[model samples]
Target: MLKIEGLNVYSDNKKILENINLEFEYGKLYLIFGASGSGKTTLAKAILNDESLKKEGKIFLDNIDITNEKTENTSNIYFILFRILLK
Candidate 1:
């Protein structure tokens, strides 16, 4: 399970997300939808811990906080993502 609570992301000190909350569970089909410039990509990058996408919130997986974890900690998410896309 993944949970994001009260997320507030910023870029160059400009707020991009506010009071964002979300939850994802295993074996579930998830879709991210939003209009252009609605912070869709930003949210993805934040979840993947992309260096360019700074984050200002707590990210949890299975009740463990992963916010600031190293890139290696995100390998599982990326692996599944690449496999699905490559298929």
Candidate 2:
């Protein structure tokens, strides 16, 4: 199971995400959707441990603290982003 507790993300002293909490269970499918500029990408970046953004709180994968873990280390986890192109 993957869990997030009190997750907050900040960019250049500006708060992008505040006090967010989420959980994902094994063998389950989840979706995150929102309007543009609603911090959706920021949340994904935080989960992937992006160093460019400042983050607070804890991210856990099966009871392990992965808040600061490198993405390379978590080979089993995958993140997919889809973009729509309009002509």
Candidate 3:
């Protein structure tokens, strides 16, 4: 299982994501969607342990704390970014 607790992300002292919590069980697929600039990418980056953003929270994978782990260490998590444009 993957879990996030009280996830907060900030950029240049401005809050990008606030108090986010989530859980993903094994063998399940989930999708996150929102309007542009709604922090979807920020959330993904937080999960991937992006050092550029100031983050506060805890990330767990299978009951293991991975919040401070390097991105390369969390190879099991995959994030895909794409946009659908309508004509």
- A best-first ranking of the candidates according to their TM-score comes to 3, 2, 1
lDDT of 2 by residue, 1-87 (tens): 778999999999899999999987765667889999999999988888888899999999779998999866653354321111111
TM-scores for the candidates:
0.79, 0.83, 0.84
Candidate topping TM-score: 3
TM-score of model 2 vs. true structure: 0.83
State how far residue 76 of model 1 sits from its true place (Å).
3.3
Off by over 4 Å in 2: 79-87
TM-score of 3: 0.84
Collision pairs in model 3: none
lDDT over C-alpha atoms for residue 13 of model 3: 92
Pairs that clash in candidate 2 = none
What digit string (tens of lDDT, one per residue) describes model 1 on residues 1-87? 788988888777788888789987766667889899999988876777777656787988778888777777686855774455445
